[model samples]
Target: MVVQNATENSIKIMKNLKLKIRKTILIVFVSFFSIFSTYAQFDGVFSHYMHNLSLVNPSYAGENNMIQASLFQRTQWIGMPGAPIMSVLSVDTPFKLLERQHGVGVQFLSDIFGVFNNQQVKLLYAYKYKLGKGHFSFATNIGMINVICNADSINISKLTTDDGYHSDNDPAIPIGKQTGVGFDLGFGLNYVSDTYSLGASLTHVNSPIISIGDKNEFNVLPLMQVNGAYRFPLDRDNGKYKINTNVLFLTDFAVWTSHLSSILEINEKYWAGVGYRYQDSFSIQFGLELFDGFRLGYNFDIPSNRLILNTFGSHEVFATYEFSLVRQKSNSTKSIRIL
Candidate 1:
């Protein structure tokens, strides 16, 4: 009789455990959906955007007319549970085809937020031409995104309960993983010259539907961005000392954000800057030309908003490498005595 009573008690505890797990799952999903549904769609944010412009603007691909590659990683809201972490890889090169200058690129990215995950791949193409004393570019991108939710990550065995029965396969709880895939499209335009650059882009123009569950579908909304940068010579020391001012504006129709920053370059090797995001955060930036063709950059963001109370801050680090084709060609020609 004691053995049977113990068995009954165990069953009761198991049932209560299952009940609490179900309730927790419900609350988590409700909170996530409630936060996301009010916005156009969830998009990753970056602090080192200038170094990774191709992530936001397709027209930026091959803008420097060189074979260039960049990698970026960002950790947002450190010390906050379920904060976002993202990474991106992008490469592009200038090419001549059909007697026209063009740019081609490929990009891959992975993002994780709490229990949600997103992976994406994109192909970018840009047409280049001359306008006035500057150059103009128009670009388009095609991509696919896979969205997922992993409910198995939750801890269920730790719960305690006194109920008499337990259903481990509760239908109300998402016990496994759910995923959906969708197509994405983007457009961008850029104009650049010796002194300045300007760009505008629109992403997710199609509003693709990502169906995580049979009954749950999210329509990715369009995001718009406009950016501009100007370079001013501070002193005429072989163009060593100069200040670059940049502004970026982003909007997803419902919410908007802006970044205004400036960098002082020294001897074409070192740079440092500071920035402010309206009602969002303050940022510090630093970069180095590590070698002839390699560069490294870092940005630290401190929350000036309410989020500071719950989290420490955010960090972004990126690196870039460029193939100096112009110098390579010049050397090749000179080596053969053709020049």
Candidate 2:
């Protein structure tokens, strides 16, 4: 009889503990939703922001003076369910017309998180003019943004009823896959020289709105970004070693984030760096030039926020290639009069 009473008490205690845990989890979820709903969704975060300048700043198109192509992929919050995954592809080239320099490019992006997926395609153009020892560029991009919500993938059976929530009975919740498309626009200004660069941009200038269904809609808000970088020779005699430092800032007026990084380059062929994103994560990067005009890079991020408790980290990889399309003059003759 005593053993039976003890067993009953033990079971009651376990049940009470589980109930408390569920309540705690529910509170955390509610708090997270309340905070998230106040902010607008922005572009996917990239650890290799230096190489992805063209994605955020249209003025970065063709800054390399060669036809360039790049590809990137990132997976965030490893071990965390429904974390973000992103991919990007872009190409740009420079041209001279009417004695003026111009640039043109195209970019494609895909981002997925939770039950939502987003795809984007943009056409970029830039006009450049000499400013001091550098060139100043004004640029713009127009694009289509498509968003998809996979409501059908949600498991209603797994949802707990302890909170008195019912997915099937909720009118506000979507029951099937929903998709929406909207127009996006952006503008940027940049200044670039051999040793340094600076840029600022605004994306989603139109604040586009898209309706997924009669019950759901999405509104994209404007985001502002600024970045700068400087490079100097560490081995001045041979100029084979150098240090590059970069900073990037992003804001949607209500929220802001920043990143600072420095890289050591050897023989212009190898690089390693470390970076910190404010209140977010710390990253390590390494890269090598695989061949002439071709390079590859990788980055690993260690979270510093609450996400660290749930995830191991994030991973990113990228590749870039650059080559000139213009033909070079092989030989030149000088007249004696000119000499």
Candidate 3:
């Protein structure tokens, strides 16, 4: 017995070492790729992506067969000047016309990063096809984005000589607010089944060019996203408690990032979860349901990178409400399959 235990321990140590080595290699490779291939400017990042699925993927609109409205807000890098702040509002509904399932939605987003701000309005359309017990959905998006830059607000006097902030007298710097407008397009596909959901989307498919200040043009590249989630019930009888495992992968024609999380929900009322963003941060999430259809959620992020030195953390909040206008023939026996 003593000999067998020693052999098992050795094997465990070897496995752990191999895992660590693989993780280290992966991090190095991703960092290298990010430094070399990245070109598109950073977009607004969100923590509660699971709750705001339709914001990223149009196909998720009206997937629950109900009228739904949601709101999301995020403040990144607490206590840091010129950090990113963003908010979005969206509403979607399903309608059947001529024996076909169709959905329509609208979204408005306001994002501010440093002296740059972008406001966008989008209209979404989706068609759903039923296949056995599941559904396949295709969606398209049409939108316009207004980009504004406040060049005059930049303060250069506070900068140190070593910090390289000496653009105060530059002739190219616009003296006032510079604005530009661009058209945006996107497409998405989503599949939903009894136990799992999967989706993929591409945004800014045309690489819209927005000229901010004079002679300065920015290209908004296509952003790719792939996400999946699976539900596991603790008890088969009532399903009062269940676990949801989710993963989201994203690329902006530059670098890649991912978020992985596991959440526990009880009686469809309360939920808690923990998640890790690849080479980014760890997050704690909490949520509650109220009054049948209203939901509130919050998330806190603890950065693992160099930003942790003087920053406290990031915060995000979201709310959603869902309601059905008319009852279906099998409403009593149907289950909620929304993301």
Candidate 4:
């Protein structure tokens, strides 16, 4: 009788645990859908946001004192139909004029999901001034955002018609491909030191409006972000090993999210890390410095909610290169013929 009771108690505990999990997943999905339904245009989230700081903050351009270029790509919600795919290419360089430091950069982004495509190009400029222990940068960006919708590809039959509405005759739905373009603006401030950094930025400051069709339009909402990072040396003598912690917070005034990450660096050549996105996913990340001035990284996200049932996960990869324009002087003089 005791053995039978023990088995019964085990089964009951398992059932209760499953019930709790279901309730949590339902709450997450409802919250996500409610927030997304209210926004027409939203920025894509990146798991490797630490390396793509310039994408959100213009002041990050040229902060490294070297010419830098990067490419990044992400595929979200694997195995799910019409999942989001995004890519970005960006370059930045520092220059001096009239004994004052300045930065300039350009970025291109392409994002696609479902039947819609978004492309953007932006030019960034930043002015830097010396502060207490680090430099402060003030920056701005101007860009053009273009959106295209393949309205013909949308299946009208799949849409619900329960409100005494005919999907085929709805004038709000475009009968063909529709495109719209709008001007975008952003501003940022950043402070960086040898061991730490902090930044804040605002995207879509102008709240650009793009009209896709006669009745359909997109109202771009402004997003605010605050980010910071700190470094701790594990080996003080040689500084061969270290730990870096990063955090980012984002909001549109209605919905908010946060990301936290910590990474361990080995000999400045390789690193591994883990990250968490609040109410979303946990991620594993690793990377290496392939060669001088070049690095590559990858991140994989595991869903923390019901998305795990429908999708495998998300994947991201990024590559970056940095180099200085000034040539290094040779230690010894060389013959003209050898040169």
TM-score of each: 0.84, 0.86, 0.82, 0.83
| Segments of candidate 3 deviating more than 4 angstroms | 1-40, 155-169, 327-338
Can you tell me which runs of candidate 4 are displaced by over 4 Å? 1-40, 155-165, 329-339
Relative to the true structure, how large is the alpha-carbon lDDT of every model?
0.78, 0.79, 0.78, 0.79
Candidate 4, 45: how far from true, in Å? Answer: 2.0
The residue pairs in collision within model 2 are none
The model with the greater TM-score, 2 or 4, is 2
lDDT tens digits by residue: candidate 4, 259-303: 999988887779899999999899999999798778899999999
Residue 16 in model 3: lDDT: 72
Residue 299 in candidate 2, Cα distance off native in Å? 0.5
Among all candidates shown, the one with the greatest TM-score: 2
Worst 10 residues of 2 by lDDT: 330-339
lDDT of 3: 0.78
For each of the candidates, the C-alpha root-mean-square deviation to the true structure, in angstroms, is 6.4, 6.0, 14.7, 10.6
lDDT for predicted candidate 4 compared with the true structure: 0.79
Checking candidate 3 for backbone clashes, the offending pairs are: none
- lDDT for position 105 in model 4: 98
Sorted by TM-score (best first), the order is 2, 1, 4, 3
Question: Mind giving the per-residue lDDT tens digits that candidate 2 earns over 300-324?
Answer: 9999899899999999999998777
